[model samples]
Structure formats: C-alpha cells, structure tokens
Target chain A: MDKVLRDKKAICVFVLPAFLFFFAMVIIPIFMSGYYSLLDWNGMSKGIFVGLRNYIDLFTSYNNEFAKSLGNSLILAGLSVFIQLPISLTLALILARGIKGEKFYRTVYFIPVIISTVVIGQLWSKVYHYEYGIVNMFLRNFGLENLVRDWLGDKGTALICVFIVIVWQYIGYHMLLMYSSAKSIPEDLYEAAKIDGASELTTAFKITIPLMKPILNVCVTYAIVGSLKTFDLIWVLTGGGPLKSTEVPSTLMYNTIFFKNQFGYGSAMALFIVIECLVLTVVVQKIFKSESYL
Target chain B: MKRISKKLLCLFAALSLTLSIGGCKTTDGTDGGTTSPDGGSKDKPTLKIWHITASDAEGNRTILLNAIKEAEEKFNVKIEETGTENEQYKTKIKSAMAGNSGPDIFFTWAAGFSQPFVDGGKVLNLDPYIGAVKDKLLTGITDNFTYDGKVYGVPYQMQVGPLFCNTELFEKYNVKIPETYEELLTAVKVFKENGVTPLICGAKDVWPAMWYYDVLALRTAGSQLCNDALAGKASFESQEFIDAAKKLVELTEAGAFGPNTMSVSWDNANVDFAQGKGAMLFNGNWVTGNVNAESSAVKGKIVARKFPLIEGGKGTATEYFGGAGDGYMINSATKDPKLAADVLFFLCEKLAFDMYEQNTGLPGWNVSVDESKINPLTKEISDMTKDSTGWTLWWDVFLEGAAADTHKNLVVQLMAGEITPEKFGQEMQKLNAK
Candidate 1:
C-alpha cells in the first residue's frame, strides 16, 4: 500500500485533472483578459489594437476615475487590517479563553459569515435608510435629534457607513479562523506559564500568538485581498454613487464594461486589479516571513 | 490489495476523462441543434422576446404580457418571453447579442441606445416592414428609431416630462400653480416657509435627477442647441448650457427639493409625493398611473402641467423634453427576420392601445382614445403634449455610451453641490472630446 501511494504516476494522474480544471477556469480567462486589455473593443465588434493606450488613459485621464477607485480600495484594505482584524482577533482571544456560553458566543459570532452578502447589503441599506432607518430613529428617540444625518446619502458619511457594514459582515469569518487555531494550542504550555507566575495576557502574547503566526498571516492576506475585490455589498447599497464617493475598482470595472460598453478599458482595469492583489499578497508574505525569522 | 486499488484509481481517471469528453460533445450537439435552420420538430418557428418590465410593474407588465399572448395567436408562431428589470435587461440583451444568441425580438430605448446595436449590424432594419404599418404609427414617432434614414425599430409609446403638483398641498400652503420660472421660485419659497418640501426628487437613482436638468436644458437652451451639444457640433461649455445648469442650481439653493433627496429612491419619492409630503414632482407622465393607482393616497388630488418657462429664454413651455424612446426591435440574426418584424409591428400596435387604455403611457401610435377611461391628470398631459412645438429626447438616452454615463454622473454631482455649473459644463465637454 505504501509503495502504491508513493507512485509518481498516481500523483500525476490525480493532479492532472485539477490542473486542467484550473487551467480552463482561471489561467485561460486571465490571459484572455490580458490580451483584450490592449484593444479598443465594445464587446460587439472587431477589436482595434491600441497598445497600452487604455492603461495610460486609466491613469492619466481625469474622467476615468480609476485612480480614485484604487485609492478607495486601498483605504478599505487599510481599514480592514488596522480596524476589522483587531476587533476579530480580540473577540477570538476572548472566546478562546474558557468562558460561560462559549459555544453560544462562537455560533453567534459566526452567523454573519454564513449569511448571503446581498441579504446583508439589503439589511444594512434598510438600517441606513434616511426617513425611517432604525439608526436615525434610535438617535431621535434618545433626544439626540441633532446627530441624525442621512447615513447613505451624504457623501461625507456614505463610505464610512458602507465600511461599517462590510466590517460587521466579515468580522465573524476572521474570528472563527483565529478561534479554531487558538483552540488547537497545547494546554501544558499555559499550565507551565501559570506555574511560572505568567499572567493570562502574558501567556497569550508570548506563547499562543507566536504559535498562531501562520494562521494570522493567512487571515491578514484574506482580509486585504477581500477588501480589494469587494463589490456586491457596495453595488447594492450605494452603487458607487452619492456622487461616486464610494467608487471601488470592481464596481468601476463592472460599470465600464456593462453600462458604458468600454470592454477594453474595463479589461485594463481588471488586469490592474489582478496584478495589485498578486503584488500585495507577495509583499504580505515577505513581511510575515521576515518577522518570523527575526 | 495494492494492485486492486491501483487498478481502481486508473479506472476512475479514465472514466472521468471519458465523461468530460462526452459532456463537451453533447453541449456542442445541442448548440448546433438550436442554431440549425430546421432543428425544431414542430411546424411553427419559435420566437423569443425579451423585455424590461418587472412582473409587479402593474399596468406595464399586463400590457406586455397581453401583447405577447395576442401576437402568438395572430402570428401562428410559438412565442417565448423573458422579462428582466430595466438596468439588468440592458446588460443582458447586449451580452446575449454579443454572443450571437439573443432573442428574436427585444425591447430597447430609441436613438443613441439603439444606435450601437444598429451599427454593429445586430438590429434588423424595419423600413421594409414600416411601409405596411406606417399609417397606424404616430407621425414622426419612427424618426427616433431611424439611423441614416433607415428605421430599425417600432415605437411603442410616447413619454413626456410633466410637473405633477399635489393640489391639496398647494391649497394648504395657499400657493397657486406656477406658470413661469419666477412664479415657481415664489411657490418654492412659500412651500419652504410652510415647512413643506417643494420638490420630491429621487437623486439616488441619478436618472430621476437628470429629468430636472433635461427640462431646464430644453427650456433654457432650446431643442436645437441641446441636439447640437449632444451630437458634438456645439460645446457643452456654451453659454446656454451654463445658464441651464445655473437655473437648476438656483432652484437647489432655494430649497426646492427635499433635504434627503439624494438618498431617497424613485419608489420612496413617489410615495412621499402621494402621501402629500411634497408639493411637486417633476417626472414622466407614467407617474400618473401610480398616483391614480387604487392604493395611492394622492388619487384625484394631483394636477399635471408643463414646466414653467424660463424668463427671457428663447424657448417656450411648448418645447418638451420627451418622445417615443422605449420600443421593440427585431434581431438581424433571426431565422426569419420578416416574421420577427411582423410580430414586432403587430405587438407594438396592440401594445400602444393597451398602454393608453391601461393609462400606462401616451400611445406612440395614433388610435381613437376612450377619453373617459384615462385619469384627468393624464388627459391634461395628453392635451398639453398635443400643442408641444418641439420635443427632445432625454439627455441620457440621446447621448451614447461614456458620454451618457458622464452626463448622469455629472448631474448627480451637480445636484449634490460637489461641482459648480462651470465644472459640469467642462466635464460634459470632456466627454464629447473623448
């Protein structure tokens, strides 16, 4: 049995099918998008090769709005790392410690992760509705009428409101990932730390956190990449509107391709996103690895 | 045991490979069957029709479904229909047509919206079919669907922008119906003083807000200038365009719209107007049906009127911002283009009468109206449009592709107070330059 398991032919046979599926689904479409990015096509006609002109226009033209969208994505990614992840990590740490109703709390925290994003978006949009939204109604009932503002209407607050909804929807997902990893740590380590007079916080920081570095790296990567590609929630809630104040790259690409019929330009935007995600993922891995070595 | 397991693994791999190959072959066979000329087993050809009316859109959906049923009976062809929401329908039709497998007949907006399809040779030119049905269609209604003097679609209905006033609110505030721009401003001031929102605009959708800009542009700049600007002959930076923008800005500064206008959706805005929370709504005549619906709070309390004339402008109130924009077109790649065209014409003719009877819209086809059936507000709008000296299509419909998007986004920004009139003009000109 061991000899059969170690056979290279078996390994090749098993891997080939998956590799073929991946090639057809992912690799081919990416190359096709890259090829289309250099052309001026409207998805219905013969494409004219323009050679990086679409890329140049995306960065240089004032009307393109691609740069603004990229900036918005970066802001979302930064917020996810600095704000969302920490909240998720803190909850995970608390839940990991044996507490009352730990199972109930874990289930409650993970509920948002399983809910459809579109349903979440619709729910949040109602919560942010101007006239009868619960958020404003609550404020008004508390005699804080002065604090009431159009949550999704005003450009000043639209992006922030959308960001809060996004953070709320996914904090559960990251928390579950961290909690399971925290649960896997040996109990003897904590027992020894307790015998040495180390506090709960100290043991958590010195032992549990170091052991969870690999999973932490994975969660950070997911958070950042997920932020860069967010569309459905933003599309449903704001549609990159209130004067395009919440325009992100994915929605911009969709509008360019579908609404404006600028397939070539949209393809360029898409390729840019693919490259940006790839580069950021690599940089994140390097940073984590360097820290581990230190 | 090892040998048996190895054999099973090889068998599984070979079985999966054969199954995948078989699946691909079957898909190709089905594709050919559908596209082949004589693939249908039945004698009648199947005709697919696509449209953009939500099932709950009340009268509009009923009219479309009834027409489809009538056409199937009259044309002796099996008819299949699919309906999608408006924005989704646009993308769905375009993508399907791009893939060369779109419906035989589809609904689309006229002019710039249909131009790309015509230019791509995906739309069948309906000029040959028009000769037989020209007498039934309204005069000049077909012009919007014509490119290079070739008609490519059938106009189904006419839509014109009208100011719908809540008469109860007007009486409550003791403000008369405005007849001129200055009087409208006075009315706005009076309404504001009484703590009432003068205009209930759904700027969140962006298109609803564009209606104000469209009317103002039509009145201030006149139809000729607006047409020239849209056609790239005149600059959007022209003085007339700036003046129109300034007029809209002036209305905004006077607290004309609700404070939360930018957040309110079109449905919510309609509700607010119906509930007597707003004094006026500037939208298409189609809103009359909604206001006159069984559940509407503003039934019998609304009055329709032309937008007030801009003081000292070259244009008059008779110049309207609307026309026969929505209609049906036949696909050029259909198995029987002539049959599709026949079905389209018959369906459109039937649809026009149904739309008028249902009070869904103004009929693009000239038909004897049962005047007693229509709501008084719609009757007033129809009478007003009969005297219209000129008409201009909506700016978003008249401009194609990126320019149309720019116009919509810029108008939203203009309403949001994020950009000045000059910036709006400059940005519009930039779109033309592109």
Candidate 2:
C-alpha cells in the first residue's frame, strides 16, 4: 500500500481524471469568464477589450441593479441560516430520536430535493397564484378577502414568497445532513448520558450537539453557499420581477448574458459571483473553525 | 487491507469518471451531422429544425408538424424537430447559435431578435434561393428578414394590433362602447365599479405589458415617430412618448387592468379572457382565432374593435402596431445549405397558406385558400389591416435584446407605479443614448 501510494503512475491515474474534470467544468470557465469580463462583447460580434469597464458598470449602473440583487441574495442567505437551518435542525433532532413512521417521514421530506427545480417552481407558483390558488381560495372561503393579495406579484412579498418555497424545498436536505450526523454518534453515548441522569435536552445540548459540531459546520457552509448561488427557483417563479423584487445576482447575470446579449458585462457579474461565493465560503469556514469550542 | 480497499475504490471512481465522459463523447460523436459520407443513414438523412410551437398544438404547430411529415415523405429525410416554449426558445436558439451548434433550420423572430445571429454570421444568407419563393411573397414583406441587403429568414404569418372585447358584458352592463380615450375611461370606470376586470394585460410575461405601452406610444407619437425613436433617429424624451407612458399609468390607476396583471402570463391572461374574466384584451390580431377556440367561453361573442383614439395624439386609427411574424433561418454550419434552404422556403410557402386557412394569423403571402370560409373574427382583423397608414413593429421585437428587456422593465415599473412617466421616458431615452 505504501509502495502504491508512492508510485507517480498511481497518483496520476487517481488524480488526473478528477483534475481534468474540475479544470474543464470550473477552472477553465472561470479563466475564460475573467478574460471575457475585460472585453466589450455582445456574445455575437467582435469583442472590444475594455479594461475594468464592465466591472465598474456592474456596481454603478442603475439598470444593472447589482447592489439590490446582492442584498436580496444576502437576505436569502440569512434566512437560510437562521430560519431554514433551525427548522431543519429541529426536525433532524426529532427524527433522529426515532419516532413512529420515521422512515416514511424521512423519505417524504427528501422527495422535493430529488424532484426537478422547474417542477417545484411551477407547482409553488400555482400555489401562490393570484386567483384559483388554494391560499386565496381558503382566504376567500374564510371571508378574509382583504388579506388575499397577489402573493408572488407584489414587491413587498415576492422575495418572502420565493424564500418560503426555497425553505420548503431544502429543509429535508439539510435535515438529513444533520440527522445522519446525529444518528452516527454511538448508542453507548446516550446510555452513558442516561446513567449520569442527563435528560434528553441535556444530552442534546452537551453530548449530541457538541458531537455534531463538524457536520453542523458542514451544513452551515453548504446552506450559505447554496443560498448565495440560488437562481433557478427564483428565475422560474418570478423571472426577477413584478418590479425587480425577487432579482438576485445569478438571475441578473443570466438575463444580462443570455437575454441582453451583454456577454462581457455579464461575465464581469459571473466573475464577481465566483469571487463572492468563494470569499463567503472561506469566511463561513473561518467562523465555523473559530466557533469550534462552542 | 482497509487502506488497499479504499485505494481500489479511488481507482474505480477515477475509472468511472473517465468511462462516463468517454461514453458521453462516443454518443455525441456517433450522433454526427445531418448527412454522412459513408451513407449508412442516407436512406433517411436527418435534418434538424428548432421551433417555438410547443404549447399551441391547434394552430401553427400542426402546420409545422405536417410540413415536417410531408417533407419526410417527399424528400425521404428524417427531420429532428425540437419544439421549445416561447420565452425559452429565444434563449435556446441564441445560445445554440452563439456556441455554433445551432439546428439546421431554426425558427426566429424578425428584426432585432434575428440581428444577433445575422451579425454573428451564424445564419445562412438565403439570397441564393429566395428567388424561388420571391413571387409568392407579399411585396416587401421579406424586408423584416433582410439584413445588409441579404435575406436571412422568411415570414409566413403576420399580425396587427387590435382591441378585442367581450362586448356581451359591455351590453349587459349597459356600458357605452368606447371609440375615444374619454369613452374608454368611462368604460373602465363602469367595469371596475361593476366588479369585472376591465382589461387583462399579462405583465408577468413583461413583453405583453409592453403591447399596451407600444400601441399607446404608437398612437401618441405616431408610427413614423415610433419608428424613428426605435431606429435611434429620434429621442424618447419627447412629450409624446411621455404621454404614452402617462396614458398607460392612467389606465392602471383607473383600475382598467386586473389588480394582478403583474402575476399573469399571456397564456394565463388568455385563459382568463376565454373564461369571461376580462372585458377587453388589447392584444395582437391572433386573439381573433383564440377567441373562437373550442374551449373559449367568449367564442364568437367577443368582437375585435379599433383601439380608442387618444386625445392630442399624432397617431390615427390607421397607424397600427405589429406587422411582423416569426420565420425560419438556416444555420450557416448546416451540412446541406441548399437542402436546408429548399426546405425553409418550401415550408415558408406552405405555412403561409396553412396559417391563413386555420385563421392562425394574417398571412404575409397572398393565400390561395378561400377567403369567405375564414373565421369572421379573422376577417374583422384582416379588414382592420387593409387600410394601414403605417405599422410599427412590437417595441420588444423592434428593440434588440438588452434594450428590449430594458424597455419592458421600464413599462412594468411604470405599471407597478414604481416609476413615474417622466422617469420612464428619461430611462427609455437613456437606452437610445447608449
């Protein structure tokens, strides 16, 4: 085994395919986008080299609306961490305690994660639709007509409405992550805690939670990054509108690059997204490390 | 032994990655071009065509499918047809062309939508074979498809803006028919007070909202001025353009449209209109056929009318909106450009007559189909276009991508009351300044 580990041929064979795949999908695209960011291309005609103009315009341009979009993404990230993660953690805790119909509940909760994003988006859109939607139908049936407004169409509520769907779709995924981690702690630890007269709450707080730290950190990082990179659900739900209420960086980048044909400007946005995601990811990891003793 | 198993697993994972990628490549490479030199599949040479008729099965979709079937039988070719939904098809074709992997013949809208492909040198110059169907086309109808003195696409259908109304409700509610801005305002007031949705504008599909603003702008600024503004020969900051925005805002404020116009897609709006939820829908002439569709509750009862004349406006009832149609363009990289061009023009000619017979659209080509047998609503639509003073293309189609989206966004913002009419005009003027 030591001989095989030391062998250059084995190392190359093991690493080359992964390195190539990563290079092809990620590294090369980033470099190319970085290059494109410096140009004034319309994704069609000849691209003029315009140093830093797209990047400058991205921050400053009113139509680009980058700051607002970034703020929305940050809000989504905050919600994912504070709201989604807690609900998921609570569910994970309950499920990990081994309730009746535990397997059925787990499978049902995980169903949305496997379904296509488009399908989920469309389904949620109908649920939040102005008329004939079940929510409004219920509101009308209860004589709460005044409370029934176009949920996905109004600026004040569009982002929150979209966030609810995202929360619903991802709860099971994060729950499973924490659940498995909690479940993996040996049964002997619980027995030991019980012998020491530790209640379920005490065991959860002092034993299980501390034991689940690494996975919790992993879950938090995934949640933050995933929220930051979210585009499809919002795109399918709103296409970033009514009044640009649900606009996020990824959706804006897509519209700019594909719809507007402003490849260079959009690439500038693409590069910014990669950098933003990376910086946030790093920042999150650092925070988790610093909180290790918590 | 544990370490050795882990190492083996790693090796197997790498092997699988390589195998999967290689497998994908093998499949892609084997699925090669339209015509093969070795002639294994020459008995039924496959041609690729991308269309935007995935949802509308009753109309032009059938024409396209039948044309494909007929072409298959006649030419002994298997056509690989891809149908995408409307908004998505724009991205699909544009990205495919940008990546230089576009279909052999792809459906494309006229003017600004096709400009990128034409500018990218992705579309085959159809000048060589256009003469075959030259006489069949209406005079200068091909102008929209022409770029730099070369024809790149061919149109089969055309539409003009017309105000379609559920007049039965208007009569039931004792509302006066609107022929002027004042009357329209009164009608809106009556309808809104009576709990009926005065207008159904699908602002979620933002381009549909632009139809109202475009026609309003066309009325205020006139077709020539609208054309000039679009051509960047004039500015949008003019009062006429501002008035168009103001008038649209006025309608929204008057509660003319449903409260949730921003949430409804065009298809949704169409459904609402058919269900008699809306009193009026100021849309393209194509709605004439839709109004007569089997599922429509307002069938034959709805009537097409002229948009109300705006006071102090330059546009007359004769000045129209929408005189363009989606067409097919051949990809420059097509394996058989000649064959692709032949199929394109043949389909174009066949679709022209087929669309007319089905009342799908006002055909750009003079139809051989019996005129008297066409739908009455389509006849009203056809009659409306007969005395056209000038027709302005839909602003979203007239403006190239970014400008088009910006235009639609500005209109939506104005509709949502987030932006003032002055601001909308100023922003539009900024697009021209760019």
Off by over 4 Å in 1: A1-18, A138-147, B1-41
lDDT of 2 by residue, A119-207 (tens): 99999989988877889999999999999999988888988999999988999999999999999999999999999999999988888
> Model 2's CAPRI class?
medium
CA RMSD per model (angstroms): 2.6, 3.5
lDDT for each residue of candidate 1 in B140-166, tens digit (9 for 90 to 100): 898788899999988889999899999
Residue B331 lDDT in candidate 1: 84
What 10-residue stretch in candidate 2 chain B is worst by lDDT? Answer: B31-40
Give the range of the ten consecutive residues with the poorest summed lDDT in model 1 chain B.
B32-41
Candidate 1: lDDT of A177? 93
Clashing pairs in 2: none
> lDDT tens digits, residues B1-434, model 2?
98779778878887988889878866665453333334337556667888888866557788888988887777777787889987788788877777666788889999998898888788899888888779888777887888888899888888787888898899999987788989999999999999899988888879889999998998899999999999899999999999999999999999998788888888889888988998999998877766888888999788888899998999999988877657888888788788888888777778878888878878888767898888888888888778887888888887898999899998998988889999998999988998
RMSD of 2: 3.5
Q: Candidate 1: lDDT over CA atoms?
A: 0.86
